[model samples]
Target: MPPIIDPTKCTGCGVCVDVCSEDVFFGSKKGKVPVVTYPEFCVHFNCCAYECPEEGAIKVRIPLPLQLLYKGGDR
Candidate 1:
């Protein structure tokens, strides 16, 4: 699934954009917000989610099959 952005909680510090090696997001200079520029490369890595300082700024959903494997601590 795609990475979810919660505008209310997003401080838009661009941390996620900077941390993402895949270039999945872009920072907006006019506003304190980051936009999801490339949704397809997300890969449900959830790195952005964890990197976000806001409690729930980014939420990435992994597919069921992969979720199961991830749940087993493989990922």
Candidate 2:
């Protein structure tokens, strides 16, 4: 799933944007919360959440199919 940014916690530091390999986020340099432009491009790498300085600022939800694939099991 795509990362969801908490506007309240996001300081618009652009760390999430800079760390994302899929270019999922976009925003201005004037401290605006980055927007998720392409969710399908996200590979669930968790880089955005990992790089976010604010706790709970970015949340990444892996889809059920992807979760099963990663877990090596069937539901």
Candidate 3:
């Protein structure tokens, strides 16, 4: 699965857009959170998630081993 953005926690910082190695964010405004422009480039690297200031706002697919760390266990 691709990354999903939670607007509530999003500070509209636009850091995700700026740090993206690939041009994945297509939003016009500077502060507007970028949209998933190139889903294929995501690669589940969690780059955007790491840059985001708000917790749980930017979520990328977790790696298999780490997935078990999320309580309730990996699905």
Candidate 4:
């Protein structure tokens, strides 16, 4: 799934844009929210969300298959 940015919480620090290696998002100017230029290009790696300093600013959905694997540890 593509990353979802929470406008209310986002600081527009461009950390997400800078950290996204897949280039799924386009960088914005200083203090501007980054744009999701290629949502489909998102590989669900979550680098952007992980690196974002703003809490709840961004959310990335993990793929179901990967989610299952991740949840497997809960067993």
Q: How much lDDT does each candidate structure score?
A: 0.74, 0.81, 0.74, 0.81
Give the root-mean-square deviation of each candidate in angstroms. Answer: 4.9, 3.3, 4.9, 3.4
User: Which consecutive 10 residues in model 4 have the weakest lDDT in total?
Assistant: 66-75
- lDDT of candidate 1 at residue 3, scale 0 to 100: 80
Q: List model 4 lDDT by residue over 1-75, tens digit each.
A: 568999999998888888888888765565887888888788887788889998889999765665654344553
Q: Write the per-residue lDDT of candidate 1 for residues 1-75, one digit (tens) a residue.
A: 468778888887787887888877754442467777777777777788888888988788765566553345443
**Superposed model 4: Cα runs more than 4 Å off:** 62-75
Off by over 4 Å in 1: 27-31, 63-75
Local accuracy of candidate 2 as per-residue lDDT tens digits, 1-75: 567878999998888888787787744353788878888888988998988899999999887767653555555
RMSD over all Cα atoms, model 4? 3.4
Count: clashes, candidate 2: 0
lDDT for model 4 comes to: 0.81
Instruction: Tell me which of candidates 3 and 4 scores higher on TM-score.
Output: 4
lDDT of 3 by residue, 1-75 (tens): 457888888878888888888756765357776678776667677788898888899888654544544457555
Which window of ten consecutive residues has the lowest lDDT sum in model 2?
66-75
Which candidate should be chosen as best, given TM-score against the real structure? 2
Worst 10 residues of 3 by lDDT: 62-71
Give residue 23's lDDT in candidate 1 (0 to 100). Answer: 76
